[model samples]
Target: MSKWNPEQDGTLYRMMQEVVASAGGSVRGVLWYQGCSDCNPDEAPTYMSRFRAMVDRWREDCGSERLPFLTVQLNRYTAPNPTPEADACWGAVREQQRRAAREIPHVAVVPALDCPLSDEIHNSPAGNLLIGERLARAALSEVYGRPVHCRAPEIAAARLTSPDPAAAEPTIEPTIELTFDYVAGYLLHTGSLERVFTAEDDAGLIPVKQCEIVGPRTIKLTLTRAVRGESRLHGAYERNPVAHLPLDSDTYMPLLGFYGFPISGAQYDENR
Candidate 1:
């Protein structure tokens, strides 16, 4: 989600950085599975590049130089569509993910076809839970020495304040102009209770904000700071069937900034 542009871009990276900083950086892994609704066949192939770009951005933003990325292959049991156009191109999408796993470091793919589902066409209810669990397992496997789970949140519209030229720091204050986009479905903000940051051998997390479905396929969230930081950004959002959709190839593309940073923090934050 973004404020100036609804499309996934650098602005969203800034927001995530702020959330991480406030919650304390050096946090646990990042689980991502957006694509189907966002990426089609023609351009889905580029997801390999986008995924690599996203990995670099995550490392920079979270202040972790080697943060791990866990991804999933496209596996929809639609009984094979007859026509070419009707096909969602799950194969090409899967290939993109496979390529990413092979090309990118700290990258691993979680198999989905093996999982049971009622129907791939509209598998919302049980599918959502399955995705979350699979994400958690993959994350744990990659990070090693700890338990991990999806920090799924409400898909909130992106909101931002007018750029304050006078201010030196990036603008984090609330704004009236909110850019609406696909907010997530499962997890909202981290949570009320603060948990120990010792979940991962060397990871930290904290629940900071939450969001819900507000429009056709978007969500909005109000962010708060999570100081203590948990091992997993611990918190469970009220269940929603269609909370997270497969992202587009562009979803992982980084919107670089003036000096090549989508987000600007103190030099101290950089080494933290």
Candidate 2:
């Protein structure tokens, strides 16, 4: 998203160059804060390359390839769209930003997906404080190696409870088991555990029969029906996901955004 078109109006870029050239030239890093417009469905597809290119161009202009660059992931919004798929463009942009941070060295992303918005677009003052704290933590950890815990909690492993081969006609379907990394305390739920997560396959969103936290970091999600084929698991992905336990680290930093994990039931891998 931009206030001025770069092709038709080079005014902003020219002004930026002039300012960079005229200043004492002591700039160390760049803080970027523009992408709201790119959340549109028409503009989201090309946002990654465009944003990456701009970062490269800016680095070249500033005479540094390894210059530290920090960016914020798009926060959550309650748009008119009801389905997560239809409302996924903004999330797509955020995913792109996260991917860039992972692929490009010396780059970091501050997640704002959990911040509450005052309006349709802008975050509330409290939300901004959370974002600012996250950004500060990212800078301190990524740039200064201060050992701050900045990463959000992510799914570390998943498993499907296999039905007993010798059992008679079973009354219950199999369940999906998930484990997470960076869990501070025990995983808590806001309401029902079923409200905090989702299970789906090609057939579409499957209703969750039951959800039980097996341990502090492991959870079992039972589906109404068995998965037909390859399926996916998601947590806090909805536009207005059921607020659950405040996932925090031992340092008390809250987990942000949504998380996805694959359940194969064959083995549990911690590398994801």
Candidate 3:
């Protein structure tokens, strides 16, 4: 079964059809966890569109328009010393997976970044157990209409806050307040918060001076310098980011990694 091509005649789709025919004509839902192979320069950019098309075809073949799909976000891939381009590809695919979950109907994505990797790219047995529990929770809640908290926390908004609103001059140090959604309770981080959050402008990556949980669902990030132009906030976006990541205090569900969340209130600097 090729990961890049869903149009092949004798592949996973055909095999799935055979299985469904042998058993029953219908299935409860589809659990998809295959995206590592698509993490490449050639495939990563088009991953979301292709995936959406594949889902449409699956629903058509399965005779259900609103068929539920539970997908797993790409986990850590720590082989040898990977190149920068490879890391970018992996992160692109992950961000695309997140987009699919938000854009598509009846589709949900579960985080696997906290899960342990058995090999270079595959999840460990113990990690698989955790993923299985997460998948079951999503299926029960989304498909069976059961009351279960399955959705992982996601970045809602990132806005600039004045360090001192009453100051006469514009403050050089800008504070960004990041708000999250789907959090069951307060947000908590396990390791250094600096490694988990970053900001980027036209120049490059900006150093985060300080990070603190200012509120139940909010995190305040202090930037070293003022934003030059349009800036973006990234969290847990590296190929193999920190193992101890930010998670929900109540459900312990890890927050999903995001790529280019626009930081509002950035000063437009033409001469950067």
Candidate 4:
């Protein structure tokens, strides 16, 4: 049994105040490792709002509005659930944490999606080390303004290519070309690249026949057929995703988790 209520009664917040007060009410930054307790279905939905409130309150207490707040996105962990819905709870909380970096300013989320687990709920020492290094790298680049390689590749654009219209029936299969940001070197994969990505439209996940790196930062995904309507490219977006892509730099930082982009409906032309 524990006497301290970290979330319910502001125990951790008060402790933060004590530390800030002892430091004369000013600090350089803050590191947060929380939200695991809130991953339950009953509590996960409110995490983003509650997180925002806590950050705001901490800023007020520490006397800085735009202070850098670095947080660790929860590492992957789950019991074997035969049902897809059983996984949504943790996935929701993880996504909410990821959104904080995008929605808020001067904040960063250290992604840990690729880290191997020691048990059902614990990240191994190596995994923890990787997470820590990522945090430091983010602080250096985002907070200190150093020119460092810390960002994961993000989807920039996707286009659907079809066979020449002059063909009798245009029987050639269509391909989706994907472009990405932060292209310092080639994208690497241990096995088939198709295993790393998914193309989904309203019809659900479209099977990818092949994924070939056409350019240093671009990949061509050959689909089983041409698609219509809006589609999406999800890279490293799975609850558990392939973890290795290191840019050619001083520190070959791996791609962070959960990258996604929309495929515009305009890309598909029936006239083709």
Q: How do all models score by TM-score?
A: 0.43, 0.77, 0.92, 0.77
lDDT of each: 0.40, 0.66, 0.84, 0.66
lDDT of 1 by residue, 65-114 (tens): 76777775544545543343323244345555655665678776654433
Where model 3 places Cα greater than 4 Å from the true spot, the runs are 1-5, 8-10, 165-171, 268-272
CA lDDT, candidate 4, residue 158: 78
What is candidate 4's lDDT per residue for 149-215, written digit by digit as tens? 6665545677777656698777556688877666556665545666566677766667778888777
Whole-model alpha-carbon lDDT for candidate 1:
0.40
Residue 2 in model 3: lDDT: 52
Task: Find the 10 residues in a row with the least total lDDT in model 2.
Answer: 263-272
Off by over 4 Å in 2: 2-19, 80-85, 165-172, 184-186, 249-254, 258-262, 266-272
RMSD per model, one decimal: 22.0, 5.0, 2.4, 4.2
Candidate 1 scores a C-alpha RMSD against the true structure in Å of 22.0
